[model samples]
Target: MKIDLFITCLNDALFPRTGVAMTRLLRRLGHEVRFNDAQTCCGQMHFNTGYQKEALGLIRKFVADFRDAEAVVAPSGSCVAFVRDLYPKAAEWAGDEELLREVRLIGERTWELSEFLIKVLGVEDVGASYPHRVTYHPTCHAARLLRVGDAPLRLLRNVRGLHLVELPAGDQCCGFGGTFSVKNPETSTAMLADKVHNVLSTGAEVCTAGDNSCLMHIGGGLARLQSGTGVVHLAEILASVETVNPAAVVEPARFSAEGLA
Candidate 1:
C-alpha cells in the first residue's frame, strides 16, 4: 500500500520523531510511505478558533495537496479528526459544493495512524518491541470525535515486552484543545491537574497518546511537578524495535525544534 504521511503541525514542529517513527513503522510493514513538502497545516487551529475564513483557505490547500494520495495517514488523531469530521462542515460554511464533494472524498481516504494500521492495514503487532511500563490516554478528538475505540490500545497490547496498564479515568481530556489551553488557562490547569493525578496513580513510567498536543500539555505538568512520568506518542512506542531501549527512543536533543523553522 502506498501511504502519504500527513505529519500534523504539532508533529512536524515539536514531534518530528513521531513522523519519522510512523514512516519507519509503515515501511517495515511493507508499505511505501511518502511525504509531500507542499503539505501545510490542516487548518484545525484556525477552524476551531473562529477563523473560518483562514481555515477555509488551508482546507482547500489540504484537499489540493492530498487529493491524489492513495491513502493519507496522520499520527495526530486531533488533526485527522478535524480533516475527517470538520472539513466537510468548513466546506459547507463556504457554500462550495465542489469543495464539499472533494472534502468528503479525501476524508474517507484519510485516517489516523492507529486506525490506518488496524482498520485499513488489518495488522497489529507491526513487529514493534518496547520494554516499558506505559498507559494509554484516549485523546478527546480521537475518542469522542473519531471514535477510534481500542484501536490504539490494541496496538499497544500487541507490542512485545510492553506492560500496558489501564489509565485511571483514561478518557478524560488532557486540557489541551490547542487554543483552549491558552484561552482558559485556569480551567485547563485544573483539568490537567486531575489528569496528572490519574496518570501518576497508574504507576506507569510513560503516558502514551495518539495526539502529541495532548501529550505536550500533560508532559508539561508532569515535568514541572517532577513526577518523572514521561509522555510519548503511540507511533514512537509502536516503532520501537527490540534492539533499541524504550528510554532512548525519544530524546529531546536528538530532534531539534530549530529544524521546524
Candidate 2:
C-alpha cells in the first residue's frame, strides 16, 4: 500500500530524523512511503491554544495534502489526535458541510505510527535489534486520546536485545502541552521535575516516547540535570537493525529548551 506521511511541524522542524526513521521503518516492512511537501502543521497548536479560526486554514491544508493517499501515517500522536478528534468539530463550527465531510474522510484514514504498525500492518516485530535498556513514556495523546494501549510496548518487546522496563507513572503527562508549558511556566517546571525524577528512577540508559514534543520536554530537563539518560523516538528504535545500530540511525544530539523554543 502507498502510505502518505503526515510529518508534523515539530518533527519537520525540530526532529527531522524521526520522520526519516518512520519512513525507513515503513519501507523496510514493504510499504511505499510518500512525503507530500505541501503538508504542513495539523493546526494542533492553534486549536489547543484557543485559536480555532486560525486553525481552520491548517486543517483544510492538511486534508488537501494527504487526501489522495491510501493511508495517512503520522509519527506524532498529538497531531494525529487533533486531526481525528478536532477537525470535524472545527468544520462544524465553520458551518462548512463540505469541509466536515472531507475532515471525516481524512481523519478516518489517519493513524498514529504504532497504531498503524500493529493494527493495519499486523506486525509486532519489525525485525529491529537494539541492545539497550529502554523505558517508554506514554505521551498523553497516544495513551489518552489515541488509546493505543500496549501497541508500542508490544513492538518494543519484540526488539532483539531490548530490555523494556515500565516507567513509574508512565501515563502522566510530561508537562509539555505545547502552549501549556509556556503559559504556566512554574507549574510546567514542577511537573517536568517530577517526570525527570521518574525517568531517572527507571535506571534505563535511554528514554523513549511516541512524541518528540514530550521527549523534548523530558529530554531537556534531563540534560539540565546532567543525567546520562538519552531520549529517542519509538520509530528510531524500531528502525534499528543488526546492520545499523540505533545510535547511528539518528543523530546523537540531546534536545534542549533553547533549541525547541
Candidate 3:
C-alpha cells in the first residue's frame, strides 16, 4: 500500500526523528511512504482554542492536500485523533457540505502509526528490537478519542529483548492538553506530578507514548528533577533494529527535554 505520511506540525518541528523512524519502518515493511510538502497543521490547536474561523481555513487546506491520498499515516496519535474525530465537526461548523464530504473521506483513510501497523498491515512485529526497561503511557487522545486499545502494547510485546513494564495509572492524562497546559499551569503541573510519580514507580528507564506532546511535558518534569528516566516515542522504539548501530537508530540525544525544545 502506498501511504502518505502526515508528519504532524509538532513532529515536523520538534521530533523529526520520529517521522524518519516511521518512514523507515513502513519502507522496511515494503510499503511506499510519501510526504506531502504542502501539508501543514491539522488546525487542532486553533479549533480547540475558540479560533474555529482560523481553523476552518486549515481544515480546507488539509482536505485539499490529502484528499487524493491512498492512505494517510501519522505517528502522533493526538494529531491523528484531531483529524479523524474533529475535522468533520470543523467542516460542519463551516456549513460547507462539500468540505464536509471531503473531510469524512479523508478522515476514514487516516490512521495513527500503531493502528495502521496492526489493522492495515496485520503485522504486529515490525522486526524491531529495543533492549531496555520501558513503560508505555497511553496519551489522552489516543486512549479516549481514538480508543487504540492494546494496539501499542501488542506491538511492544513482539519487540525482541524489550522489557515492557506496566505503568501505574497508565491511562491518566499527562496534563499536556495543548493550550490547556499553558492556560492551567498550576493544575497541569499538579497532574503532571501525579503522572511523574507513577512513571517513577515502575522503575522503567524510559517512558514511551504515541504522542510527543505528552512526552515533552513528562520529559520536562523528569529532566528538571534529574530523573534518570528518558521519554521516547513509540515509533522510535518500533524503528530500532538489532542489526544496525543502536546509537544511529534510536537518536537518544534528541529525546531529552532541552534537546526536543
**Distance from true position, residue 117, model 2, in Å?**
0.5
Against the unseen true structure, what C-alpha lDDT does each candidate score?
Answer: 0.87, 0.87, 0.87
Question: Largest TM-score belongs to which candidate?
Answer: 1
Q: Mind giving the per-residue lDDT tens digits that candidate 3 earns over 45-79?
A: 99999999999989889989998899999988899
**Model 1's lDDT to the true fold?**
0.87
- Model 3 residue 231 CA deviation in Å: 0.6
In candidate 1, what are the lDDT values of residues 1-261, reduced to their tens digit?
A: 989889877777678888888887998899888888778889988988889999998999999999899999999888999998999999898999999999999999999999999999999888888888999999998999889999998999999989999989888888988899999999999999999999999999899999989988999998899887888899988888964443333544323323323
Please, what is the TM-score per model? 0.94, 0.93, 0.93
Question: lDDT per residue, candidate 2, 1-261, as tens digits?
Answer: 999888788887778778777877998999988877767778988888889999999988888888888999988889888888989999999999999999999988999999999999999999999889899999998888889999999999999989998999988888989999999989999999999999999889889999999999998999888887889899999998863333333444422222212
Worst 10 residues of 1 by lDDT: 252-261
**Model 2 residue 87 lDDT score:** 94
TM-score of 3: 0.93
